[model samples]
Target: MTVQPGRRLLLIGSGWGAESLSRQLREQTNPWQVTACSGRQANPTSGADLLLWLLQEAIEPNALDHELGLWRQQWPQTPLLLVLPAQHRYKRQWLLERSVEGLLDQPAADAIAEALEVLAAGGRVIELQPETTSQHQRRGQGLGHRLLCSGVDQIERELEQINAVLQLAPIHPLQRFVLEGRRRELRMAREVLHLLWGQEPIPQAQASAPAEPLQIVLANRKGLTVLHTVEERLAHAVASLDEAQPSPLLALEALLPDRRRQLFEALLLEFRLLVERLQADPTVASSLWSGQQPLLRERALQQLVGAYTQLPKEGALVHLGDALVSSSDLQQEDPELADLLPSLLALIEGRPLLIDGGLQAPDEPAALLHLQRLVSNWLIRNGELISRELLNNCSGWPELRRAVLLPDLLATRQLDQLRNRINSAERWHTLVERPLAIYESRRLLFDIQAGRVEPTMVCDLRDAELRQLSWWQQAFTLLLEARDALAPQVELLINRVGGLMVLLLTRVVGRAIGLVGRGVMQGLGQGLQNAPSSGDQRS
Candidate 1:
């Protein structure tokens, strides 16, 4: 009697023993036509009788689930025969629940063929051994638990560092408040770790709250569950590091009583008004706040306003600019004005305007009106440029706009003073202007040599060496070096003495002479009035 042909079987795996399996099935008396493919390349085909998925050892549960889902989607009606490792017999129930018709433990070619035949014949076959807890699984679980413990230890170390800073470091009150809030978050993260470790029971309040359905499969290796939870919690903790924490200062304010709270509120109001006033005039703000004691200035501001406001520690000026933009009607007039305000504020504050991770130029004509208004307001209130010393130190945008605009703004008030001196009959400009110019030149040269202004451009004097020259040239160069070194000091002295002379002439001498002239004129008029008139002489 002739044997009938076996049904078609689709073999899917990593191609490890797929060819051998296909050959073995083909050599059978009633050979089954086998089509082998990798898991990623497996697709539905017409007249596919059965699917035999050879599961790799140590395969992640998520990956297996994803493969199984793809198999189901491609072949909804086709019977599935899963060839699992003996170690993964624990996953039999999971495979069965996922609508797998057959499960075999590391099945050989004949066994796979038999399982496929049974599945094709509409019968279920489960050759896997009953679920058992092995030593290897216990070791894996122990390692996972240790890893979670290590993560908890790491978090504890970070918390300890924060506590050390709070205890030992001389930090701002606002920094203290922020650090305390971070401490609370770390503490909460520690609680989560403890709960996951099963060392602590869930709180009654939290237990009473409705819990989300557990997505983790119990049939999956316990170690894998622990690893997944650890990964999720660690990621959450890292994300929380960047998130802004709630201010403890606000909580302290909340705890204060009515009278003190009212006083605190008033104090905060005054601080806000002060910040607004400072923002309105960058000159006064820079003079008062931008100095050697920046830390103290920031701390004072934080102590005053941290309770009511959430300002970033680094960019307090930017925060003030944001507030200014929000309070103005510029946004109402034009939507783009709101966007342009930040760039404008940065320009006036002598900071670089960044857009899309690059320096941006403020070349828009529409911004001109607003820029002019801001500058005019500053000038009308007698605001001066942020100290040239500060400007020389900061290497901001080197664009033509900044280079031109800043110098022009500086020259406005300076030129006005120069004009007044030139118009004076005293001719004080001869002595004052030249000394001031020399002092400024010397200062600029010093700044350039010290690597403050125009850092990319090297100073000619910086690399010059008298030793490299001939003897005569060295003598002349030595004189030049000494002169170069002493010029700044000499010019500074001259500038100071010239300033004193100008003050003496313009204020003391000029006021005294005007007083004397007014007195003489008054006395002469009184004498003439006291003298007898012509009519009185005739009488």
Candidate 2:
């Protein structure tokens, strides 16, 4: 049969299974140009629109990652649809992060057809829901099982290496998180290896029901059922641990055992108190605000205006520093803090403050040099309350809220108050650049997704780091503009100091990159943890 030209698919797999799939594709009313291959062989003669990677059930996590990487390199523009076993469903997010388009778990030809349709339309099919049926334990001594065993061996070696290093030198706090995360991956991989070999620890008796209704028990080992539950359920089940003998499986859980218990207790107590309080005053919520949602804008409109009103209007905003000689003066109880209430010394930071028109440098030249320092000290005293209010009130773009606006609000939310007191002062606008910032940030993210900007561009910089970089870049440019205003000697001095500052800032950028690298490593380990394998049998 001469199948009509249609969407080209490169189906990478082998055997009778591949033949059956190809036959199904040919039989479809909208036939596709299918090229099937054993992964060991070369790719198709022509470039494909899409890739269908049919990974075997028992493929090791590490091996799967390598194969995916190769496919991505080979077909950078082509979207990949992974046809995987039900056991490998846990890898969906890991695959998605690497730009895999769709996942069809234990797919029928119809499921494959549906997934392809979605892909053709530029939509994603993360995982096709399979019909509920009994899963029989697979039996085989296949290549995948061998690879699994090898992967487990590699993980075990890595664990030993980490343990040896830890014994010799105290690991940094950040490094410890990475180490423990790796340990979890090793244990999970070991479990999968045992399951593949039919050597998993057997449970004496199966429970009629999972102990926790919300929990999904994967395996029962040495009288302890390794289960998965949501964050909320984890909170209620702190005391449910069954005194199982110590093993490497619980290494991640070992950290903060005491702190976790204390936290659980505290939360439980707080909930009880809240319930009792609600019972006592059934009308408190109504009396508070009549259930008109405590939106950030409303809170900002009220408290934000009130807070800003306390800043001094007249001369010597700088001299307020001398009056705030003692830390206690900033506190409510101190007379000095009350007299110089919202310390002007604290809020002014060198970065241009947003107002009605555009960015404004401080009126006083001295204020420019120590703007950030002043703001930092003020926030040190009164920041917690301001932060709590803003956090509780806002929605959307949490990074923008926390990093940019929180400081903006801290510095200038009260500027309107200063304007009201003295008509000459310009009103500090709340969320002036916020709307624009949100749009630009989202646009940048979109560009990354569209492949215009590489993910690597922001991979090293967290949202805060990116925002800070943008701010510094603008600040440096603004300072350069002011260079012409100063005397030649002053301009030279400024140039030298500015260059030194830029060099120091580059160190921060390097640190952010290193932090991101560590985080990526931790995430890689985390993804490998809790993968459902043949060993994960439930009665």
Candidate 3:
């Protein structure tokens, strides 16, 4: 059956996936032109005339609402169908009921075609039947499945090489994170090498050897059942050890005993505190905001954000910095943080506190999770008492409140205090270019946490190198533009240099040719082929 002549189908997946889908669609005899872009990169209004979008849910849950909220504002009637495992659960039912069409399983080719059919029926929620026909299966599994199946051969080869390297570093806990990253990179790289091999991985990152480890767990590997768990692996290992009765500490020492034990203790302690705090009142989520480190380490954050991509976390913390420097903002009832106040009301980094052992050092992911509510409530609302207000005047996340509140305060103060309180070096430092460098830095921190990236190996100089490259690019662009002003002088200098060289060369060439011609003339006359000359007397 011929599909509609020019029906719109919005796709919001990664570039490679989109390209593969587009190629398959183009081969089809009927209409399948995209009405607009659907991924994180393209805004909704970019091509909204079609009034329909088949968007993929590429964002996280908390951020999803905000991203979708913006999408709805542009294409109000456009429909979204989330793609995830049917087993993967999300509790955002309020959002699901309103916006989502349904879930699409991990992969399957006819799914794209089915989505098109649903879009044709109008943007209402509809269930799509899985095409069991072998033909449909063939169509669905065309390029991606074939590529995945074939590429597995190459990935296995690379994985083997990595496993060999990892064997030498058994104590490296973060090696797991780095390996996981490499495997992910291998997946992403395979997609490119198979499809767009011309495009290269960022040079600096490639040279740096990932700066971290990929987190691969033996027990809780995805696609495994409950029976295949870390506990089970440990149980078997422990049983073997129990029979041998080797030094218990020696075994621990052999397999990342020091930092591993500390991290485990921190995680266990934090999780316990999280459960207790949440159990007391489910709304208290201050534990989510990270203070010791920003999102996924600062380097990765830098890479991910560009001039346009602002950090809400930074926006949250800016005002707190200002409040510390000022006293006028504090009212009689509302006091600024100081030594006079109880330590329970203390602020750590940019996060507010309950200041007991529960809020002590924790793993990066869990620590950051503790800050989310602090961000939503504090940063989103300009540090106005939100979750605190919601749960009565409890001092749960005052630090986050202050942090988000500060960006605006800083913005306001920057304009007024530009001359009074700014440092040139610091300004340039903050305004570093080369976004991927920032992202790498963040990845480094994340890797460090995961036991992939070494903290000592993560040099501040790498950030400087990226920043210098950014400056040089800008400077070179300016140089190129100034070419018009210097063109006449440059051209004149080239001509002068060429003219001198030409004059010297001409003298040597003229002398050699004259010598050769005279020799030839004498040789012919001496051989008795004498001819009359025009200048007879001289001849």
* Candidate with maximal TM-score: 2
The parts of candidate 1 lying over 4 Å away from their true place are: 1-6, 40-46, 136-539
Residue 522 in candidate 3 has what lDDT?
93
Candidate 2 residue spans exceeding 4 A from truth: 1-6, 40-43, 89-96, 128-539
Output the number of the lDDT-best candidate.
Answer: 1
**Residue-wise lDDT of candidate 2 within 338-384, one digit each (tens)?**
11111221221223433223444332112221222222222212322
lDDT per residue as tens, model 3, 161-226: 877876774647787778878978887777676574233223333444332211111221121111
Per-residue lDDT value at 301 in model 2: 29
Residue-by-residue lDDT tens digits, candidate 1, 1-539: 23355477777766647777877877787777778877545434545688887776757777777878888887888878877765663453365445566767666777777666656656556565444544343234565576666777788899989989999667899999999999999999888877777553233334332221111111221222322332342233222322112221111111113222222233333333443555577566545432312232233323322334433324443342233223322211210011223543465454544543555333211222233332222211110111111122122312211322334324445434533432461233223432332223221110111111111111122122223434654455456668999999999999999999999999999999999999999999999989998999999
Cα error, residue 339 of model 3, in Å, equals 64
Cα RMSDs, all models:
35.7, 29.3, 23.0
lDDT of 2: 0.45
